[model samples]
Target: MEKNYFNLLQLPVVLPIDGSLLSLHYQQLQRQFHPDNYATAPDNEKAAILQQSASINAAYQTLKDPIKAAEYRLSLEGININEEQQTIHDSPFLMEQFMLREQLDDLEHAQNWDELTLFYDEMIERKNQIYAQLLEYINQSHWLMAKQQLYKLRYYAKLIEQIELLQEKQFNL
Candidate 1:
């Protein structure tokens, strides 16, 4: 039973997916296949439900995260990302990212929350800009550019995660 994450969530494969509806559908599916509800069922049926429950959970996660959703879409388009080829070939963007990371790494313990917020917002804006281009390229069937955009998004996503972790550490101190 091959299923795209969007299909499993019963939603269209597009940006700005409805989170609330996805949650509702996910919970309903969980309840339907919960092992407690099948205690008296046959052994094979129980195993099947367990597998389905796992698949449903994975699908829910895939559709919940924007970056993951983009990767899922690419997979649907028969684009297998070569995981080993992770670096972006765009030299200028790589330099910008390197500088951004260096700046983040240089943050002091006394870094202002407001300043951190601004930095976070700036990274998010960059990610969003790339995503907009990605959507355009995808719609136009520009496979290479779309894949490049995904790589860009992945970098930003990882950078954002680092910033968030740093923010938590700084704020807690």
Candidate 2:
């Protein structure tokens, strides 16, 4: 299963890249090895099909998400960025996130739409900067660094969600 993930990551990791190619590949592979396809076969063959199907699903999931795709690549290089194993190497990013959260809390209490707009824009810019860093890490094959960038990207995405909620409140009022 792990080997299959490595193979899938080797393919382009974009959602729209070569449309229908991945789906076609997955379908062909599944048809040949899906557990149901081996229902009439021996027990050993059925077991093998189950194992292969599991691998296929795992590969499909990893290739579907850019962040996961990056992590899988890192894993191939002996780097594991699982949540429990991840280190906090980016203190500045953490500190910034803390400050942003504080400001968001204050804005929520004050109902300051204008300040929220400015903060949202700043956070969006920060997200773009992090994406640029992520690209650099990918280009350099710095999987660990890219994993850190992924953390920052997730944080920014969450912040965007919060900003959207604030905007909705503003619109409602």
Query: Per-model C-alpha lDDT, please?
Result: 0.84, 0.75
Candidate 2 lDDT over 25-52, as tens digits, reads: 7777777767876789988888878988
After superposition, candidate 1 runs with Cα above 4 Å error = 109-114
Superpose all Cα atoms of candidate 1 onto the true structure and report the RMSD in Å to 1 decimal: 1.9
lDDT by residue (1-173, candidate 1, tens digit) is: 68777887788877656899889999999999888898999999999989889989999888888777777788888887666866678999999999998877666454767777788999999999999998888878787788899999888999999889988887688
What is the Cα-based TM-score of model 1?
0.89
Report the Cα lDDT for residue 104, model 1: 77
- Using all chains and alpha carbons, the TM-scores for the candidates as numbered come to 0.89, 0.71
Report each candidate's C-alpha RMSD, comma-separated, in the order given: 1.9, 3.9
